[model samples]
Target chain A: MPDWQELVRQRLSGLALDPSEKEEVHVELAAHLEESYEALLKENVPEQAAVSAALFQVTDWQDLQRRICAAKKRGHIMKKRLHQLWIPGFLTMGLSIVFLVTLQKLGFNARIVSWRDSDIFFYAPWLVSLPFLGALGAYISSRAGGSRGTALLASIFPALALTLTFLLMFPIDMIIEPIIGRQADFKIVAAALLKDGIGWMLFPGVALLAGGLLAHVLLSLRPSSRETAIG
Target chain B: MIGSGIKRGTAELAVLSVLHDGPLHGYELARRIEQQTNGALRFTLAALYPMLYRMEQQRWIRGTWETSANGRRRRCYRLTPAGKKKLTPLQREWAELFHALQRLTKVSHA
Candidate 1:
């Protein structure tokens, strides 16, 4: 009754949302206002009072505009994160997993070396393949305007994932031992973790991260890739 | 009347609970909440829409355009699987708070 659509458009104007998104908000708000106004009218309220009461629902139009605009903009940020970090990270992770599986299937036994009384195991083929996977992740992330940190992170996803798994394993095992009626010796567990982690997590993580960092540094040198970079 | 401060904390629960029934457009959704609370709780247009948008972005709820029986087009919102999953923890927390408050108030009144 109060030309609610026009009122909404005028009040919510200058929002930094896409044209279609702004229109969608305008229509929804106008409909809500219209519903309120009509419901008030049905209760024998005068036209002017109904309009006034309906409009009073929003105390600060400026704040409303800011909030709606910010909410819609955050949706865009999620999309950007998907492309810049998640997609690249997953792709690199998948590639490395595939490479590792192939090497295992080919009977490429992990070469064992005695390092500081630890039987350190290294899959030669998979370890060699990491530099390329790291490069792929870093290159893809930077091209998509990822920040230096995310690009580095994407490149070393596999190592990080392995490290995360190892870290979780310690806690999970500790929890389960008590549940399964066994006493977990904390000192023994820590010593075993330290000895095993040096071989399984630290060495591979460093190698993979080094490859990723090298590619990230090379990409950072290019001015075009640096322009849209965000952390 | 419930204060905005109190409502702000429970708004997600209110919206998600009301929407758990089925999809409803913005106006109907607001009306349902107020009705369920005996008009003690009302959502202003300013407060409701932004929270709705934020929740949709979070993937807790999904919105879609629909033409109702009266042929008015509006964006209908429905609870997602994620929203349903979130409801259990929220309900548990609120129940625990209510019990704690009841205990404190009884002690104070004594």
Candidate 2:
């Protein structure tokens, strides 16, 4: 009676569903709410109270949206997973790697400057766009109902991958160097590689994490009732 | 008041038992359940609808949009063959649970 359809449609604005399917849901739910509201009114409840009571029948619209999506898109969930989770994840990682590779191709070398009695790798050039890219990825992941851990992981995948590379591949590289007749000092080479790994892990990683944190701040309104309450 | 955890366990059975009689829209189904249970099994719209959608998706129930006698459109849900088949086992399970609780706590079901 009170434009329940419009009210429902507004409440469920970001439901990731097709128009027709969503419209069907909207109509069905609106009708149910209207009926309940009318019934409450028949019981001599005030109009505003009846409206509130009917609205309170669905305390968590976001959960309803997700459950409906899960039920309706059971088969399509894998595709949706690819859309919501993997797409953003890969885009962030891909962009980070591409930018780093581009810097290498462009002959941009990192300078090691001593700071606070420790040699530090200065790579401010390639790190310029990383925060923005990371933020975009995190924002997309958040919009897709990803939690802080998943969103952080998606945004910082580049740094994590580099960390893994350093942890695993560096050891293998160290082992293979001797067989290749490169008589580099093991202690010195290990130290340098460790420093390099820490550098890559620290600066770019922090920038990306900063981006993820930024997304969290900017997306303060992001967590639906489902996310905060259920989770 | 029943805990939500317990209510969730019987939600499907409650819905199926109600629909066993005949087709009803979402609102009618919810109201009938609350009334029949003497308001002990009140279901929120958030709880009822997603389960309804899931049941429909599983081919246990079918929903058809129809015009009511009052000329208002309603989506009425009727039990499918699958739904009818499922009800017996669910009823048996609830019966077994009640019997077990009775044996344990000397509490009889109404």
In model 2, which regions exceed 4 Å deviation?
A75-231, B107-110
| lDDT tens readout by residue for model 2, A1-231 | 589999999988777877898999999999999999999999999999999999998888888888888888774566556655688878998988788788989999878878778887877777777888788777777777677776777788788776666566556767877798785465465557667664667788888889987886777655552363111
Pairs of residues clashing in candidate 1: none
Instruction: Give each prediction's DockQ, rounded to 2 decimals.
Output: 0.68, 0.50
- Among the numbered candidates, top DockQ falls to 1
Model 1 lDDT tens row, A47-117: 99999999999999999999987877788888878888899889988998898889889988788888777
Compute the lDDT of residue B101 as modeled in candidate 2. 80
| Displacement of the residue A4 alpha carbon in candidate 1, Å | 2.1
Interface RMSD of each: 0.6, 1.1
What are the models' TM-scores?
0.62, 0.54
